[model samples]
Target: MVAKIITGKTIGGVIRYNEQKVKHGQAKLLQMGGFAVKNLTVNDKIQIFKQVQKLNKRTKTNTVHISLNFSPKDKVNEFTLQRIAEDYLKGIGFENQPYLLYQHFDAAHPHIHLVTTNITWEGKRIETHNLGKIKSEKTRREIEGRYQLVKAEEQRKQKVNLLQSLEKAAYGKRETKASISNIVQEVIRTYQFASLPELNAVLEQFNVCAYRGEKESDMFKKSGLVYSILDAAGNRVGVPVKASSIYSSPTLPRLEKMFFRNKEARKQHRETLRGQIQEVLKSCSSLDEFTSRLRPKGIKPVFRINEEGRLYGVTYIDNVNRCVFNGSALGKDLSANSLSARFSLNADLPYDLEREQEVKMGWHGNEPGKRTQLVESSPNSYQTEDPTPYELKQKKKKKRKKRIQ
Candidate 1:
């Protein structure tokens, strides 16, 4: 359920992008910013944007990528995604690019699409360093807070040690943000029951429910956002506790042992699955099968190719609580991972057969041998090989000679 909002000029072209054209543009963009850029190309133009060809497009629209990564490979909910898109102009400096042109959101991970003047509103330059990585990390942290995301792996050892030393206690998910806020804000605030059972006596006031197994997912989405104390501020005492301080109490103390115990087993399970995924690799008979093949093991496959071919990775579609390991993304991940489930994956299978398009559409050689068209900028940058600019130009001459024949 990612929603996208775009602002700027909307240009349309192939259902696909002209990577060759956008490559030249990205080279130029990086040259201007004086920062190295990687895995970039254009997205669908007018048709995909679904706007009028002429200036008919309006300003201030929405677009975003929703993400779900709840359980190992399940997304909790991405009703929408939010982002800010930026296109550099002839000149713009880092300091001046502060302002964003458009902000958008969708159910999954709402994001924004910006059509910025290459030249800043005032002529200057833009600056970006590891733009993708930085943006991804920042977004992840925010989501962790807003959605109560947890680092289940970290709790493995800590929970085990605590279990051995003392009689255990249980607590439910924090109830109200304001009450939690008051307690966390005051360092002196502390509460305790005589023992594990007593903790439940107090928890009774909060009405917390503990869940386990796949059932834990039953209440994952739509759970109210709760407040917690955060420690990043060096606020050892500033707030009593924060979301970062908490581990989701979806499992009660009695059952937590079973759900959170023995990571070695889970680790082995993941390893075995990874090996099995390698065996599952096979050229898909149809596009539908190809997309459907990604689910069972938890991979979300999006169709977008890069200069080398595709740049996507193991993704998730949480609503169904399935992994979206992209078959296309396998080679980059050492060709590991699997897909053993699903029937109907996506509506549009590979390219329409009537066109006789190659099944592996945008796969260019890793080295330069073929040329793709120029495209705009986007995050979906999977690529195949293509010809060197010099070679592509040389091939054009061959085409002319054949035409002369």
Candidate 2:
């Protein structure tokens, strides 16, 4: 999920961009506050817009391009985009550059619009491909450590893997999807079709389904779909898949109730769950406190991602094995400009009390804020306020003032 942006110069005190173009679109998403930074810092919602202008001048093109490679569609989230950007440029210590991110909707693959200033935040011009590309190699490895991003030349430099070679062979032959789909059919029936719509017709009878994969991840194929076509004994076969490769029931029926479905529904579910989890932490202040909270709600706190199943991306529930908050690869991330930051400081919380106590004391060190638990599942923390014309002007002036000084 990458985005490419074309920035227009500020003319007549205004620069053109999306004017709430998504209000009634197929996916109606509204971001507020530092939503630009928090959500799409690397691509669509880059706050470093000022950098984008510089990038345009430096690159001598109206276009600011980016590629967002992901580790399995299910794992790609807002974090995935940033991780990709960081690997490509930041891992080499390009974090200090001045740049703003944006998005272009001209293609199926959504890439980022990085309008970075050729100059650093301190006004030093950056030479592209200096240490950045080398560091990008490092970032590539780090991201790959967790999940797979598309194989780049750098990885091929490291070793030869089987699937990648096949992919290349398929792609080079032209109509690779058509050529290799023969294998997919032997393993999964979905491969027999040319389009996902055809596959969807088949899933209807078996009550098969499709999901958003992970919110803001890939548009079509979720992570586990590649592994779906098999005998009850479990086997793998497929040419890999595009989002449209697997057809699900009509209207994506059998949709699971996720946090981002209905704005109100997600909000209600997250807020209520956060309150419940927090109370559990606050109540006993011990392992018992963790369990006591869930006992009544019939909710078990999962620490791993595979405890109950893939319901909400939650795997490990508490000892009780009740379905707790499904881990969101993107939902529970922390941000700098906002307060609703949730991090897993307590890796040993569910396993050992002493470890939790040690970690708690080490990180919080008996701070007052530590007494109250901070859960990040709450959804609407980054709402934007309607700024007045004067305030907007003042903000711009202040930015300029800081730049000049």
Candidate 3:
């Protein structure tokens, strides 16, 4: 079992977060403590929590939000969960405080969230400093022994093995070919991606990318693929290893076959990703908040932006299912254009006003008025406007003027 505690200033925000889950049918109110009323609404809970918070005016960080996560292998039912919650709260000196306990079903594991205030009824604040290390740690251990639950350290080891020991491919730390080969092979064998770019999206997470050279280059014409390690800035850093040289031989032809196979294989799992995204979107008003909220749920949102910083594409990588999906493939509403429009509606400034400010500040590169269009280089890969061709044309013109002079 793993215990995580989050401290906040507003108890209402924490209450609403759990209540929203209940509304979506993803969670249930399992137990309520210290409340005189038997049945209470969301607003009722907030008002009750606020009344206690008002007791200590100086305790700004009064809300204590905790989640107790159990291993999936552990068959913990509601009765056991309630017993653990009650005992754990008492052990942490929060037995007397008013707390709402919720059992969340959104994730694969069995977990319960406890929302309460650290401020007591007597206007005294419970010291939260080192609370996790001193009190919670001791309590968690005692509970584990009492229930015969899987220890947290053992659970972590199991998770690492389940992830196949995958790690970022640092250029100098390991043998380049071997590191890239292991990562690419594991990704190809486990993940479902229909195109090179979708595959690259997953690879980039490990600081590696599959490159086919420039479009006009002979290598690209030959349909050659090379695996290269990416630096911290996403630029290719070491010697590019040919696809044919690797033992697994993940060449273009083989990958193309896998792409066709994966298109159908990953369809059934799309709804799982879509549902998680929709739930997170309900509470988040901005892109950054959306990304942060999804991380704990094992979903990574990859946004493709142009040089002007306009979002052109969005992809979701569902780590739990080992699947990659472009937003449009899931549904029209999940597409980048739709998401951008939603965010604009939630933004403080109007979209046009923000654009005007950006242009005035010269935030959109040197050519402030240049209209950047997204060019679909492939069925799945959306390439933003590349200025290299235009820049080169201007450089050639300067050279000719120098010769004329």
Candidate 4:
């Protein structure tokens, strides 16, 4: 289970957000705590939470909004969800706080949102600093074990196979708006993309792309964004849907916020992707070979070729981590210029079994022929590699010609 804690100033906004979901049949109130009333209307719930927040006038960000997300594989019933919510609240030091739990049916995953205030009945504010990383993380682990729920970490470790699983938005096959909405919402929630291009790299695999018009256009001036369905050839083929029209309202402002958040959220998985790329590089003789090898490992390599047919950029969409990273972001060694240089040198070389075996045995070890893992290596380390067998053969030919002359 994954718990996301969001601290906001207003409790009404959080309550209304969930209440809106409830009214739309997209969510249901599962449980409530620390209240005398067993059942309450939407307005009553909002007013009660607002009154509670009023007690702690000094606490500007007293409202604590949390979302507990579960893997789709978990068969969580309503009863189990409430129990988990209660235990999670008690575990995270919110046992005495007034909170409401809502089961949201909007996404593919099973998850619930909990809206509560940190203010106590005595008007004391609960400390929320580092709450998500410290307390909530611990509580999440315990709840997962108690309920036998799928661990969030385990879910991340599995290969997602997004290209095969997520169907592209076909304009005429189904309702274009709904198709685009579903794809856009799912990508926004699941993937860690720090920019629109990075996001489009993943979305294009599903035949959808986010579009912003020319810089001088009125829509661009107003910061408008739209989602468009792409044909197989990648040209936009259908009517564009405004970002605000989507259910989640993935507008430019909201997406920009997510971009910042994703940059930090995806840091933990960076080294893993770098390590995978370095491992594949040991035997890959060309860019094509590198792309082919990484695909099986659930990494999609998107290369940007210039008009002159030169490779100028690269991005890796790691399905295992659900993160997108540009080559330069990984490190200077993995950047487009560096990789192009390395591939050029190895272009004529035959695959070396010894190097391939070294990678399979783990790159970093005391074993002979094994090299240090790229994650721990310096940026210039690739330049220090031993000459390939093909290079050695070419040198020998040069020596033979010199001796004959």
lDDT of 1 at 27: 11
> Tens digits of per-residue lDDT for model 4 on 280-354?
988878888889999888899887554455455667898656899877778767766666678763322122221
By TM-score: ranked, best first: 4, 3, 2, 1
Per-residue alpha-carbon lDDT of candidate 3 for residues 17-89, written as tens digits (9 for 90 to 100): 7887677565899999999996988999999999998999998999999999888788899999999999999
Please state every model's RMSD to the true fold in angstroms. 26.5, 25.6, 22.2, 16.9
Clash numbers, per candidate: 97, 26, 0, 0
Those runs of model 3 whose alpha carbons end farther than 4 Å from true positions after fitting are 1-164, 345-405
Any residue pairs clashing in model 3, and if so which? none
Q: Candidate 2 vs candidate 3: which has greater lDDT?
A: 3
Report the Cα lDDT for residue 265, model 1: 28
The TM-score of candidate 2 is 0.25
Residue 248's lDDT within candidate 2 is 21
Put down candidate 2 lDDT per residue, 1-405, tens digits, no spaces.
Answer: 222222233321111222221321212222222223445422343334455445345543222233342212224555555555555446545455433343323222234334333444444444544333454455656766655654544422332211222221123333333333333321131122111222322222122212222222233223222212222222222333443342222222212221123223223245555555555544444434555666566444323212322111121121111112233311332111011112233232232222122111012112222221222221211111223454666789899999999
TM per candidate comes to 0.20, 0.25, 0.48, 0.60
Query: Candidate 2: minimum summed lDDT over ten consecutive residues — where?
Result: 333-342
Q: Which residues of candidate 4, in runs, are more than 4 Å off?
A: 23-26, 34-41, 106-108, 151-156, 163-195, 221-224, 228-316, 323-405
